[model samples]
Target chain A: MHVLIIGAAGMVGRKLLDRIAHEDGVLGGEVTRLTLVDVVEPTAPGPLDAITRSLALDLSDAGAAAQLIAERPDIIFHLAAIVSGEAEADFEKGYRVNLDGTRALFDAIRAEGLKEPYRPRVIFASSVAVFGAPFPEKIGDEFFTTPLTSYGTQKAIAELLLADYSRRGIFDGIGIRLPTICVRPGKPNKAASGFFSNILREPLAGQEAVLPVEEDVLHWFASPRSAAGFFVHAATLDLEKVGLRRNLTMPGLSATVRDEIAALERVAGAKAVRLIRREPDETIRRIVAGWPRDFDARRAAELGFKAETRFDDIIRAHIEDELGGKI
Target chain B: MHVLIIGAAGMVGRKLLDRIAHEDGVLGGEVTRLTLVDVVEPTAPGPLDAITRSLALDLSDAGAAAQLIAERPDIIFHLAAIVSGEAEADFEKGYRVNLDGTRALFDAIRAEGLKEPYRPRVIFASSVAVFGAPFPEKIGDEFFTTPLTSYGTQKAIAELLLADYSRRGIFDGIGIRLPTICVRPGKPNKAASGFFSNILREPLAGQEAVLPVEEDVLHWFASPRSAAGFFVHAATLDLEKVGLRRNLTMPGLSATVRDEIAALERVAGAKAVRLIRREPDETIRRIVAGWPRDFDARRAAELGFKAETRFDDIIRAHIEDELGGKI
Candidate 1:
C-alpha cells in the first residue's frame, strides 16, 4: 500500500513516520511507497528512505492539492495546520492555510475520484481546541464544538467536511481529535500551553523552567507515542462501526500541575522537581483556565484506542521516547 | 438603516419583506433603503417599493457578494441556499452556492470593513438538518452537529464561519436553525419533507394530498410566519446575550402526523380532512425516519424568538396569513 503524509515535517508527523518505519505490521499492511509533503521538504527515516519521496508544497495554492492527489495513495494522513496563536493573530493567513488548504485537499480527492472509481483512507489530525470555554465537568462524545479560536474553528469545519465526503464515498475519512502532547520535544516556545511541556521537559533535562500557573491547575494530555498510535489505529479500524460521526476525541490523561511534580519526583528525583521555578504569568493562567480539563472520551476508548492512565506513565513514556530511555 | 435580503424571492424572505412593510418598529429602526437580491429578480412590496432596489444576482457568481457589500447595508438577511434534495443531487453546485457563496459574502464584508469601519447584523437562515439520526429524546443547545446530507453539511460549515466571523467583529452574525416549516405556502413539490406541509396545506385548500408516513411519525416544525419572525428577532436581538455560540435551533412544535390531522380537522372541519389521502411511501418513510424528531430549543425561546406552541396554531397561521383569515 502507498501512504501519503502531509505536514510530514511537523513534530507529530515525524513521530508517525518513525513509528511506521520502526514497527512492523503497525499499519496492518506493507507500505510499498511513502510520499512526504510539507511547506518545507521533509527528510525520511533511514529505514524507509529508499521508498520515500519528499516534496515541498503549499496545499492552499491553486492546483497543488490536485498534483498530490493524482498519485492516489491508499492512506493519507493530513496533519498540517496553522497553530492557535498564529491563526488568531493573522486572520487571513490562518483561514488561507487552515481552512482553504484543507478544503483544497478534500476537493482534489473528489475531483480525482470523478475520473474513475477511487476511494482512499483519509486520517485527519484534529485538536481538543474544537471545543471552547464554560465546558461541562467532563465533555462527552456528544458535546458541541464552539471553538474559541480561529484554528479550532478551521479544524471543526474540516471534520464536518471529512464526515460529509466520507459519507458520499469520496474518501473513507477519520478525524482524530488529539489531546495536548505533553513533554513536547525541542526548545521552549512562547505558546501559553508551552509551559505545560516546558516545566516537565526542561526540568528533566537539568534546566530551570518557569511555572506559569498554579499547581492546582489541571489540563488534558497524551504522550507523542500515543498520538502516533492513534493515527495507526484509525487507519486500520472498521469505519462501519464509527457510523456517520467520523470525528473521535482520542483518550487522554487529565492531570494537574501538582501531579506532574509528583511524577517528576518519582521518576527523576526531587532535584528535577526543584528545577521548576515559580513565576506565575496572569495572562497565561487566565488563558489556560478556559481550556478543557477533562473529557469522557468513551468512543475512542471503546474503539480500542489507549492512553496513559497515570501522569507517572506519561512522564515515563516521554522519557523513554525523547530521552532515549535514560532519564 | 439599510437592509439587504440575499434571497428576497424565497418564501421566508418574501414574508420578511411583507412584515417589514406592514409592521412598524419591527426592525427597531427606520429603513432608509432596502436591497433585494435573488437568482431571479424579486418584486418589492408596494409600501417599500420607492426605497427598494431589486436585483437579479447569484451570490455564488464572482464579484456579486463584493458588489453587495460595497453598499454596506446596515442589516443583511442571508436566506439563500440550494435546498436539500438539489444539494444532494448536484454536489459541485451545492458547495459552490451554499459553502463558497456564503464565504464569499463574509469575506466581502470583511474587505469592506478594511476600507472603512462597517459592521452589519447578518441573519443567516440555517436549518435543523445540521443534526442527524439517533438523537436523544430532545436535542439540546450543546449537541454536536453531525449532518446527514450535503445541504446540512454546508449549513453547518456556514454556521461555524458565522460564529468565527462574529467573534472577530467582522459582522454581528446569528444562525437561525429553522425547523421543518409546516403549512409552507407552495405547490406540492418532490422534496421528501414536502408532505409535512402538503398534507395540511392541500387539505385546507379543498384539494387532495397524500400522507406518506405513518400516523405516529413525529417531526419538528414551525410556521412560515415563525421563520420570518425568527429572522427579524435575530436582526434586532442583543447578541451580547448569545455570547460565543452564535448559532441557535429556533423553537418549534413537535407533533405527529395524527396530531397534524386532528389539528386540520379542528381548523377546517372533517370535510377538509377528508381531502387527505394515505399513500404510505416506503422510500419517504425511510427517509423521514432518519430526520430529527424534536429539540429542546430553550436558548432561542429565552432570546424572545417565538413559535406556535400547538399544531392548531400552525394551521391557523397558514389560514390567517395565506387564506385571507377565512377557513
Candidate 2:
C-alpha cells in the first residue's frame, strides 16, 4: 500500500510520518511506500525501505492538486491548513488557502475518478474550533457547527464537502475533528491555545511559563502521540460502517487549566505548578472563551478510535517522548 | 429606494416583482428604481413610472456579480438557485452556480467597502432543504444542517457566508429558509415536491392530480403569498436585532398529505378531492421521504413574519391571490 501525507511538515504530520516509517507492516497485510507532500519539502522520516517519495508544492495551486491526485496513492492524509489566528487575521488569504485550496484538492480527486477498481482512503484533519460559544454540556456528534472564527468556518465547510464528495464515490473518506494537542512539542507557538501546553511543558522542565487565562478555564485535549494514533486508526478502518456521514469527532479528555496545573504537580511537583505565572491577557481570554470545553465523541469511540484517559498521562507521555524520561 | 432582484424571472421572483411594482409608493415609502437580473430577461411589471432595468446574464459569470455590486442598490433580493432535483443530477453546475456565484456576489460587496456607512440590505432565499433526515418532531433555530442533497448543502454554505459577511459589516444580510410553497400557480414543475402543490392545486382547479405518496407523509409548507411576504420582511428588517446569526426559518403550516386533501375538501368542496387520483410513484416517495416534516419557527414569528395557522387557510389564500378568490 502506498500512502501520501499532505502538510507533512507540521508537528502532528511529522509524528504520523514517524509512525508509518517504523510500522511499515499493515494490520494483517503488507505495506510498501509512503509519500509526503507539503507547501515546504518535508524532511525524510529515516531510511525506511517502505518509504519512497517526498515533494513540496502548495496544494491550492490550480493544477498542482490534479498533479498530486494523478499519483493515485492508496491513502491520502490532508493536514494542510492556515491556523486559527492567521486565518482570522488575513481574511482573503485565509479563505483562499483554507476554503478554495481544500475544495481544489477535492475537485482534483473527483476529476480523476478513483482509477476504476481501487479507491484511495482520504483522511482529513479537522479541528474542534468548528464548535463555538454557547456550547452544550457536552457537544454531541449531532450538534450544529456555528464556528466563531474564519478558521473554524472553513473547516466546517470542508467537512461538508468531504462528506458530499465521499458520497459521490470519488474516494473513501473520513474527517477527524481533533482536539487541541496538549504538551505540543518544540518552542511555544503563537497560537492562543499554546498556553495550555506551554504552561505544562515549560513548568515540567523547570522553566517559567505564562498563564494568560484563569486556572478555571476548561478545554478539550489529546496528546501528539494519541493524535497520530487516531489518524492511523482512521486511515485503516473499514469505511462502509461510517455510512454517508463520514465525519466524526475524535475522542478527547476534557480538562480545566487548574486540572492541567494539578496534572503538572502530579507528574513533576508543586514546585513546577508554582512556576506558572498568572498574567491574564484579555486577547487570549476572549479567543479561548469561544471554544468548546468538551465534546461527546461517541461516534469516534464507537468506531474504535482511542485517546489518553488521564491528563497526567498525557503530560508524562510528552516528557517521556521529548525529554527521554528525564521528568 | 433602489431595489435589485437577481433571478427576477423566476416564478416567486416574478410574483415579488409584481407585488413590489404595484406597491411602489406604499410599503416602501416611495421607490425610485428597480434592477432586474436573470439568465433570461425578465418582463417589466406593467408600465411602472419607476426606472426599471432588465439584464439577461448569468450572475455566476466572473465579472457580472462585481458589476451588479457596483450599482449598490438600497435592497438586493437574491432569489436565484438551481432547484434540488436538478442540483442533485448535475453536481458541478449546482455548486458553481449556487455556491460560487453566491460567494462571488458577497466578496464583490465586501470589496466595495461601506461607502460612507451605506450598506445595502441583502435578502437571500434559502430553503428548508438545509435540514435533512432523522428530523426532530419540530426543527428549531439551532438544528444542525445535515443536508441530504447537494442543493441543501449549497444553501447551508451560502447562509454561513451571509452571516460572516454581515458580521464583518460588509452588508446587512439575511437568509430566509423558505418552506415548500404550496398551491403553486401555473403548470407543475419537475420538482419532486411539486406533487405537494400539484395534488391540491390541480384538483381545486377541476383538473386531474396525482397523489404519489401515502397520506401520512407529512411535510412543512408556506403559501407563495407568505414566501413573498418573507422576502419583503427580510429586506426591511433591522438586522442588528438579528445579531450574528442572519439566517432564519420562515413561519409555515405543517401538515400531512391527508391534512392537505382534507383542507382542499373543506375549502373547494369534496368535488376537488374527487379530482385527486391515488397513484404512488417510488421516485417521488424517495425524494419526499428525506424532507423536513415540521419546524418551530418561533424566532421568525417573534420578528413578525406571519403564516397560515390552518392548511385550509393556506390553500384559500393561494386561491384568493392567484385566481380571484374562486376555486
Candidate 3:
C-alpha cells in the first residue's frame, strides 16, 4: 500500500510522517512507498530503502494538482492551508491557496474516474474556525457555519464541496475540523490563540513568554500527536459508515488560561508558571472572545475518534513527542 | 423615497409592483420614483403618472450592476433567479446567473463606497431549498446546509457572501429563505414540488392534477402573499437589530398531503378533494423526499414576520387573494 501526504512540511504533517515511518505497516497492510508534497521540498527525515519520494510543487497551479494525483496513490492526506493571520491580511492569496488549491485537488480526482474506476481515500484537515460567534455552551453536530473570517469561510465552503463530490462518487472523503494544537512546539508566535500554548511551552523550557489575554479566557485544544492520529484514522476508516455526511468535528479539550497554568504547575512545578508575563493585548482579547470554547463530539466519538481526556495529558504528549520523552 | 426592483417582469415582482402602487407610500415614506429592471422589457404594470421608469438590461453583464447602484435608490429589491429545475438541469447557466450575478451586484455596491459614502437596503429572495437531505425534526437558526442540488448550493453561497459583505459595512442586507409557495396560480408545471400545490389548486379550478407522493410525506409552505410580505418586511427592517447575520428562514405552515387534501375538502367540499388524481410518480417522489419538512422560525417571528397559521388558512388565503373568494 502507498500513501500521499500534502503540506508535508507543516508541524502536524511532520509528526504524521514520523508516526507512519515507525508503524511501517498501516491497517494490516505493508506500506511500500510514501509520497511527500509541499510548496517547499519535504526532507525525507530518515533512511529510506528506495520507496520514499519528495516533491515541491504549487498545488493551486492549473495542472499541478492533476500531475500529483495521476500517480494514483491509494490514500491521500490533504493538510495544506494558508494560516489565519496571513489569510485575514491577504484576501486574494488566501482564496487562491486555500480555496482554489483544495478545489483543484478534488476536481483532479474526479476527472481521473473517466479513464478507469478510481476511488482513493482522502482525509482533509479542517479547523474549528469554521464555527464563528454566538455559539452555544457545547456546539452540537448540527451547528450551522457562520464564519466571521475569510479563512473560516474558505474551509466551510471546502467542506460543502467535499461532501457533494463524495456523494457524487468522485472519491471517499472525510473532513475533520481540528481543535487548536496545544503546547505547539517552537518559539512564541503571533497567532491570537498562540498564548494558549506559549504560556506553557516557553516557560517549561525555561524561557520567558508573553501572556496576551486574561487568564480566564477559555479555548479548545488537541495535541499535535492527536491531530496526526486523527488523519490516519480517517484515512483508513470505513467511509461507508460515515454516510453521506463526511465532515466531523474532532474531539478536543476545552480549557481556560488559568487551567493551563494550573496544569503546568502540576507537571513542572510552580517555578515554570512564574516565567509568564501579565500584559493583556486588547486585539487578541477581542478575537479570542469570539472563538468557540467547547463542542459536542457525539458523532465523532461514535465513529472511534479519540483525544486527550485532560489538559495535563495534552502538554505531556507534546513534550514527549517533540522533546523525546524528557522535558 | 425611491426604490429599484430587479427582475421586475417575474410573477412576484409584478405582484409587488401592484401592491406598492396600491399602497401609495412604502416604508412609511412618500415614494418619488421606482426603477423597474429586467432582461425582457417589463410592460408598465399600471398607470404610473410619471413616478415609474423601466429599463431592460441583463443584470449579470459587465458594468450593469455598478451602473444600477450608481442611481442610488433608497432600497433595492433583488428578485432574480433561474428556477430550481433549470438550475439543476443546466449546471453552467445555474452558476453564471445565480452565483456570478449575485456577486457582481454586491461588488458593485462595495465599489460605490470607495468613491463616496453610499449604502442601500438590499432585500434578496433566497429559498428553503438551501436546506437539503437528512433533515432533523425542526431545522432551527443553527442547522447545517447540506443542499442536495445545485440551486441550493448557489443560494447558500449567496447567503454567506451577503452576511460577509454586510459585516464589512458594504450594504445593509437581508436574505429571506422562502418556503415552497403553495396553491400556485398557473398551469401544472415541471417543478418536482409543483405537485404539492397543483394537487389542490388545479382541483379547485376544476382541472385534473396528479398526486406524486404518499399522502403522509410532509413539507413546509407559505402563500404568495406571505412571501411578498416577507420581502417588504425585510426591506424596512432596522438591520442593526439583525447586525451581521443577514440570512433568515421565513415563517411557514408545515403539513402533509393528507392535511392539504383535508383542508381542500373543508374549503371547497368533497368535490375539490376528489379532483386530485392519485397517481404516484417516482421522479417527483424522489425529489420531494429530499426536502426539509419543518423549520423553527423563532428569529423571523421575533422580528414580526408572519405566515398563514394553518393549511385551511393557506387555502383560504389563495382563494381570497387570487380568486376573489370564489374558490
Most DockQ-accurate candidate: 1
User: Candidate 3: where are CA atoms >4 Å away?
Assistant: A1-4, A27-35, A47-58, A70-73, A114-117, B1-6, B27-44, B48-74
Clash pairs for candidate 1: none
Could you give candidate 3's per-residue lDDT for residues B198-284 as a string of tens digits?
988888888888897999999999988888788878877788888667889999999999999999999999988888888988888
Worst 10 residues of 3 chain B by lDDT: B41-50
Q: For each predicted model, how many residue pairs clash, with residues at least 3 apart or on different chains?
A: 0, 0, 0
Error at A88, model 2, angstroms: 1.0
* Best candidate, lDDT: 1
Query: Each prediction's DockQ?
Result: 0.91, 0.61, 0.54
Comparing 2 with 3 on lDDT, the higher-scoring candidate is 2
Query: Per-residue lDDT for A2 in model 3?
Result: 78
Error of 1 at A183 (Å): 1.4
2 versus 3: better TM-score goes to: 2
| Model 2 residue pairs with clashes | none
Q: For model 2, give the RMSD to the true fold.
A: 1.8
Error of 1 at A287 (Å): 1.1
